[model samples]
Target: MINRDLIEVFSDIAREKNVERSELATILEELFLYVIEKEYGDSSNCSCIVNLDKGEIEIYSEKTIVKEVDDYKVEITLEEAIGKEPDAEGDLDVGDVFVEVIDPRIFGRRLVTTAKQFFAQRLRDIERNYIYEDYINRVGEIVIGAVHQIQGGNVFINIDKTELRMPRNEQILAERYRRGDTIRAVIKSVEFTSKGPDIVISRSDNHFLYKLFEMEVPEIEDGIIDITAIARHPGSRAKIIVKSNDRRIDPVGACVGMRGSRIQAIVRELNNEKIDIINSSEQAEILVSRALSPAKPVQLFIDDDKNYCIALFEDENLDAAIGKNGMNVNLASKVTE
Candidate 1:
């Protein structure tokens, strides 16, 4: 209480850490209890009361009043109980526990050292839970973050309240980030560790493309179109299949929009990456035909037993069908398989 700066210091920590002022109170209480344990040998019945307004912390050790003391830590003679509390002489029974106020300052240097240890660990634990609670339900969501730092060839991004890791593997090959640059990614996983939640985000994930379309296209948002499958090359090109519940609606047309306005927004978000929109079909051959786009296969033979298909097209369509590096066929095979 003598150091009024304690209140200001706590205020600054709460503000900077993005946690409630009350959370610091909880930490202070635990720190005081830790000090108590160091000074008193046992603190099972010990409790700490922290008044953050005055920057004051008090420790109380409670023990049951008994006729005879078997364990001095847990049991106190009625005389000793009455000595601590004057009214205990008549009002309290042998089994009734008495609260004894212990001076937290008595621990002195040990208190300061122990308090630091407890505060560091407790703060980390609380922060981990805090991070986990913040992003648990946000998994599979696309969030915007600023590049915080690049460590060991991996990117760490600063989101709304905290930072998250975006490993090299999750990054788009063509995408680059500088400090403070804004980037968007899908929340792939949130792992809670002893220190904090290890949030893994990705821009290369196929789900990122799916979410971008859902955000840009009203038909997809309204449930008129369902994106069934996506095959992506991350910052290069991707093929997607969509289907409509309504017979009158053309899923591909609806997704592309008039003048290509709708799909263009998604492309821009992906840094002008190419996207192929195809209609989904129930028939395997029809689906495979649509999957292999910009190339018209003249004839196709399906062998369900072998789980393979023979797709024959005019020799002129060979280069286009296989794509520049067989990416078209590769993506088609992924969709069909």
Candidate 2:
């Protein structure tokens, strides 16, 4: 007879976040029957029911009751069926001939052990899927993780209780992180594959700076200031364009903080990367000149299509206009557009 206490398995899963024991139970039963059929065993006629209350489980061999019982292979005589169930009639349901608690020992010690192994494997698969979906939904946001281990070409990070591969290509060139270090990065993607979901992270993304500005500047966070664009060289320098929704608020001053402390904290994490916050305006001439700040441009000229800008500076100021490795011009172009 099927035990009613098996409902407890579903109850525990309901309390937990992701475990669905009802679905797992169905898979376990299917796997057990498949293995039994392959071994050409009599277990093909057996069924199982879980008893959660007593923490016990049982298996039984089932047979249909027949009038004459001509075919013993698929049917049992009414006389034998009635003895198994006193209330059984000729038209009794198939439940009447089911043997109660068939000694699991009859299947041999090895057969009983196989069922346990199949159940464990299915449970592990369900847990992995639970963790995978949790991470996938938080894509494009910054998250902190622990460095689990350094594989040959990639570092494995433990985030949301799952190991994710951080390859060398995704890591910043000058940044070197060791095991046990807590690091943060933006989630680039959550790709689902045959094995599982793969979460990709990036430390050098331009969006990282935009997010940092949102955190450091109260004006931006509260919607008084808006970040139009940002460009980063990662561990070296970055440029951000900002505008204020309110007439009185100064977007640049708010982000810089008193004595340059706010932006400085972000600079330290990026290995002293310099940040230049510029004003964003609709006027091409005004915006272009402001974009190239820290380098005064006396004469700023734009092309016919206004795609590129040319600046004329004194001989002494030309070097300042284009900083080391042309970083100043590169950042200016990115922010201006």
Candidate 3:
């Protein structure tokens, strides 16, 4: 009688833990073999037979045929071998190996339970490793998830394989998350904790803008144009510096799309935040001038030693240069940095 109940229990565990059934069976097999070795002494020539249909287990021990038995667990004399095998003397030699059947019940209930616990712990380790590897490579990439819970002012989201906490500091002030609402965030980092690997996700991160723009514009995805730098005020405004590898392609126009269609999509995703797509330049003055867009800079004073530059603009365009609450200049400084 195969223990259908035992198999079913394992099936339930596999489903709950997101593990493969075959992998669970392999872990159990290795656990049993280890238990058998601990109970019996030497297992260099040991084998386990699992009969799931019969709900039976059999362990066999192999002992070497030797002229003199130095270790009783691994070796047997010719006379002893012959006693176990009637015609062993005619077909066996002193250096040969033979199998002996051993009772599986000898391991006892306590040992079997201990082995099961060991198997469970190993399963947890495998699960942790799988999660770590899954999220580590996704750092700085965007993922779509649904809000699962709100606790202590922190939002928890459910993504593909695990839950991520959007720290209160990493969230946008204008954004509100409710249960079942789908949201997009960038994976800022992955940290290993005592419990498991913890993934830190963010909606305010600069990479969030890069990822959204890439999704909205095909030129960026095709490598014709690429984001060289990004700065975000999150929920308010952002600036992205782009460069085209091919001279024929206009980086700014490509990102802005035809009549602002592509940029509108990105704006909708970002809650209507203002975005300034600037062309990247290798020269410091041109880069600073481009970083302060909409309001053209009249002059740029670069101080390489102090690592700062002063941007001069007319009084009429001062508000455009500084933006609301100095947001534009702040984002420009971040972009230049």
Stronger candidate by lDDT (1 vs 3): 1
Off by over 4 Å in 1: 1-25, 49-58, 63-99, 109-117
Q: lDDT tens digits, residues 1-337, model 1?
A: 3244654665676676666878888887777766666666777898887787777766777888889999887788889888888965788788888887876556667766776677767766777788899798899999999999999878999877688889999998888789998988999999887557899999989999989998888889899899988998877889998999889999988889899999998899888889999899889989999898989899999999998988998999999899967899998888667
Q: Answer with 2 or 3, whichever has the higher TM-score.
A: 2
TM-score of 3: 0.74
Query: By summed lDDT, which 10 consecutive residues of candidate 1 come out lowest?
Result: 1-10
How close is every model to the real structure, measured as TM-score? 0.83, 0.77, 0.74
> Could you give candidate 2's per-residue lDDT for residues 31-67 as a string of tens digits?
5465555454456577766544454456555676666
Candidate 2, lDDT over the whole model: 0.73
How well does candidate 1 score on lDDT at residue 112?
Answer: 60
Question: Which is the leading candidate under lDDT?
Answer: 1
Over all chains combined, what TM-score does candidate 1 have?
0.83
Which should have the higher TM-score, number 1 or number 3? 1
Who wins the TM-score comparison?
Answer: 1
- Backbone collisions counted per model: 0, 0, 1
Put the candidates in lDDT order, highest first: 1, 3, 2
Cα miss at 144, model 3 (Å)?
Answer: 1.1
